[model samples]
Target: MKCIIVNDDSEMRKTIGKLIGHSRGMKLLSVFNSTSEAALFLRDNCVDLVFFDIQMYDVKNLEFIQNISERTFVIYIPEFSPFVNTTKKPQLEQLSESTIAKRFKKGVDEARIFLKLIKKEKPDILDDYFVI
Candidate 1:
């Protein structure tokens, strides 16, 4: 899957990009520190998934995603994001890993649970693969 990371912190963006890059079926297309840059890029391009930070230095995450509602899947990675409303959004899944190590070295059980939740919530992302 083609993916991008949007965060003001360059280190955070790289960390997240590495995780996505190392994933089995995911590709890190690009990482941007500004939402405006990401937004402009998304306007004329297509991405399979967007991993966005809720609190960017100069942008509102929700507003940016709202402006790009063109069949792209979004996964919010925020410190204080609310999951209470995630269940109501189609193909939305809450990722709780707060650190690169936690995401990259997650245990099999945790990975299994995360994968199951993602598959159940966003089956279209995995429909072509027999397993992920």
Candidate 2:
């Protein structure tokens, strides 16, 4: 799967980027330290997966995520577990908050598993991660 990393922390970006690179059947297309740069890149390019932080400068990450094609899956690396109120966001309403919590709590293991499940296209395993 083609992917990108968008995080303000350089270490976080590198860690996630390396995880993607080390994973089988995944490609790290690019990495951006800011959401604005990422948004510019996303406007012209199509990617299979995006791993990004929920808190970004100026832009509301949910709005940016909503603007992207539904075909692309998003895995949010939120600052903390249970931070986002899913009900407030229309795009995230269908997904389970518990699942998102588990993801945020598990770190790299969850990310690796998410990508693997996505690659296999198994909705059952994927149901634990995201809905769309």
Candidate 3:
């Protein structure tokens, strides 16, 4: 899966980039320090996954999420406890900072399954795969 990281923290970006680089079937496409930069990239490019910092600027507006395509999945990285409402949005998920490595791996695994189901055109089971 092609992926990008958008975070103001350089260390966090590097960390997540490395994880993506090391993960099988995953590619690190690019990294952005701001939401506007990522938005500009997304305007023309479509990636399979995005690792977005929830505390980043413009995140509160939620315009960024609305701008992306439904096929794209997002994993929100929070500096603290995440409180975003993920209710009907199966494409969106939050990664706990305390267990980032484990959660990230799980998210990637689930995304892979989701993509496979999408490729198989199994819409019925898609809803069952994502709890929230």
Using lDDT as the measure, which candidate wins? 3
What is the per-residue lDDT of model 1 for residues 12-122, given as tens digits with 9 covering 90 to 100? 676667666667777777888778889898888777667777666674666786786444555656533353455453222243455334644443233345455565777
**Model 2, poorest ten-residue lDDT window?**
86-95
Ranked candidates, highest TM-score first: 3, 2, 1
Tell me the number of clashing residue pairs for each predicted model.
Answer: 0, 0, 0
Ranking by lDDT: 3, 2, 1
Q: Which ten residues in a row have the lowest lDDT in candidate 1?
A: 87-96
How do all models score by TM-score?
0.58, 0.61, 0.75
Q: What lDDT score goes with residue 130 in model 2?
A: 65
Q: Which stretches of candidate 1 lie over 4 Å from their true place?
A: 79-132
Name model 2 segments beyond 4 Å from true: 80-132
Error of 3 at 85 (Å): 23
- The true-versus-predicted C-alpha distance at residue 105 of model 1, in Å, is 9.5
Q: Quantify all predictions' global Cα lDDT against the true fold.
A: 0.61, 0.67, 0.74
lDDT of 1 at 109: 30
lDDT by residue (tens digit), candidate 2, 61-91? 7677777655567777654335455545333
- Model 3: how far is 103 from its true place, Å? 1.7
